[model samples]
Target chain A: MNTLFVKAPAITLRFVLLLLISTVAMVADHRYRVLEMPRGWLLTVMQPIQFVADWPAQRWHGWTEVVAARSHLLQENKALLEINQQLATEHQQFAKLQAENRRLNELLQSIATSSLPTRYRLARIVQVSLDPHTLQVQINLGSQADVFLGQPVISSAGVFGQVVHLSRYSAQVLLITDSSHALPVIDQRSGQRAIARGDGPSGLLRLPFLAAHADIREGDLLLSSGLGKVFPAGYPVATVRSVSTPVGEKFAEVVAVPVADPGKVQEVLLLWPDRAVQTIEEPVTDDLVDDQADDGDHE
Target chain B: MNDVANWRDGWLILTTLLAALIIDSMVLPQFLGSFRPDVLAVIVIYWSLMAPQRVGVGVAWVAGLLVDVSSSGLIGLHAMVLSMQAYITLMLYQQIRMLPRFQQTLFVLILMVLGKLLAMAVLGMTGRLPTIEFWFSLPASVVFWPLIYALVQRWRKRALLPS
Candidate 1:
């Protein structure tokens, strides 16, 4: 018998004690959030580990970019240039319409509800959640970059998610596809408001609360309603894929596919909604919208 | 162990644990994501069996805490599961040490499956119970165990050789 090993009784005692402590911690973290401060400090310590883990993947991406065919790059550039020109043409009309809407809002004295100008910062995805059940990702931005809880995250395609946990150098984003996530969205064609809840790893959103007789249909585009103040209004979210109304059920089973493909997105934009419109930052001019789009491209 | 040997041993163990954490955090392809093994648990179980006096329930608990923080799950979920796993491994290490390699792999599968079940239970408590595909990790970890065991054994032999 090895005398060096801990006694069985001692092992049992330690196990029970540690189990109790961890249980307390789980409750504190989940219900009370008392562990947030310490979690932040631990995440700061973990930054180096995360960086080392991400290094190989980042290098592989860089290598692929360097080795990409010239023809492929040229094709991508051509397509992007075409898209840019089309957007520029649309912005001319959009700028004029925006000015007219602002003037009309000012005349009506109901200017509080308009979707204000937004500021954006680019971020790279550093780490995705290890748990298959939890739909969250950690980005390379945090409190150090003025990122706060509930900041909206968007890809060039559409709404992606929002920041949920913050450390000094990194933040965790709860993807809009997590079962626990829900967004308030408006049907662009019908102007009907509904809540879009995530359907876990299936990468679909569910409109569970919509009544059976609701005026929703397949192919309807959903946009952020801006009712919750988390996502900005007018940004595309998802498109309804299927709607089935059972004969006896009160709510229709509507499923929509998110516009932003979470699997393919490597970069995302963190948005800062301009809360105070104290001074209309830029005068109404055709160049204003062009400048805004250019700034977004720079990010 | 002398001070120098002890210091070197500590570094070896820490390096293995850090490697496990790094692997745990790496993003797997979507098709493979659900099948990724619980690498940290496997490492903790190995250490608990090989060096029970040095890496027991306490070490397991700390490792689990790191996993919880890294995975951003409820803070204590993995901690509770891993500590429990370590405690059981410590108790059975001597008996299991006598088993052949194939049986040992089977034992690891059982241990890891139990840990997965416990994790699923905790997630269920929060109403986030995963789909049946969550069990896919069992076969993966089972396949990974022999490689890790061989590597760690070789590492231990080199670093902790007697004077």
Candidate 2:
């Protein structure tokens, strides 16, 4: 009885202390956002460590960039040159049609919305997740640029992801290929509505519950439906790769490959639309009209 | 002489523990991060095994608190787990001390995994499991146990021996 009494007090005290601390922490974390300030401070303190951790990968990337032979660069340059030439020709025609469309829109009393001045902020990819389970990338864009939560990010090819968390000088993006990520997408060919969800590791997107008889076919381009309003409409989301169905299934399992070169692109553009532009010039309706006029003018 | 050796031992252990905390939080890739060997856990466990008198549940609690604060996880989560871990390690110190180094490492590994799994489960129940990367860091931590033991043991021996 004496020995038990001696040990019990110590154990009870320790247990009580732990219980008190846990209750305080849990309550504080749940009740107030006061912890976020300190958490952010900790992140800032840990930034140096993040930089050092990234050094190896950055160095490896640098080495690869340097070791590419002149011949390969020349070949790439030549191919780009030809592509640029074709694009330049297309651009000239597009500009002419655009000018004519603007004139017709003015005549039709269409509201002219000034284009939002998009500023390009270059960020280096510091960390990339190789895990097939979660597709996320951390970039070096801090909060200094006003990159807020839920900002849409895109590579030159297409929409990449969105800024989920932003530190002072770093942000974590939830890429389009993560299982938890879903984007409202439309079939370019049939205008069928469906949601595109990321299927991790395979780097593919699954458009689930697509009606078995849905007019979706392989090679059909998918664009942002913008139902969520997070992403601006008409951006290329993915290209339909396959459409399949099991016997008696109501929905065809539609798979797509994202248009963005998720592996290669280091830099991405953050779309920050001015509220004034969004309110005035609905780009989707304007662009559709311009496309129709251009086809008519060409014929 | 024993006191001096012990003092040096304390300093060495403290420094290594701090380094492990910083490295575990900082340098490790988030993909391999969850299993990033529980550097702080290993350090605390090692110190508890080596010098139970110097390190105890309080030390574990404080160290765990630091880990919790730095981990971006719920506050006190690591602190509670770590304190419990230390207490458990302290309770089993005699048995752990007698085991071969490899077996000791395996025991430590199991404890580390338990801590991680426990933390994750708690977080999950709270609806705050941040990322899947959290679990991936375990294997890396397990793999690092032997190396950590060898290095720390060498350092301990060097400091304890006459200079």
**Per-residue lDDT over B18-131 for candidate 2, one digit per residue giving the tens place of the 0 to 100 score:** 676656544444344455556777778877777776677788877776555444445677777787777777777788889998898788778887887877776666544646
Off by over 4 Å in 2: A1-39, A80-89, A93-117, A128-133, A276-299, B1-41, B48-84, B98-103, B119-143, B159-163
Candidate 2 to native Cα RMSD, angstroms: 8.9
The estimated TM-scores of all candidates read: 0.89, 0.72
The per-prediction i-RMS, to one decimal, reads 1.7, 6.1
Minimum summed lDDT over a 10-residue window in model 1 chain A is located at: A290-299
Please, what are the lDDT tens digits per residue for candidate 1 over residues A1-299? 34666679999999999999998998787655568678877888888888888888899899999999999999999999999999999988987898998888889999455665467899999854455667888899988997876778999999999876788999888888887678889999998889898888789999988899899999999998877667778889999999999889999999999999987999999987776233335321111111232211000
Q: For each of the candidates, what fraction of the native contacts does it recover?
A: 0.70, 0.22
Off by over 4 Å in 1: A1-3, A127-129, A276-299, B1-3
Give the C-alpha miss distance for residue B71 in model 1, angstroms: 1.6
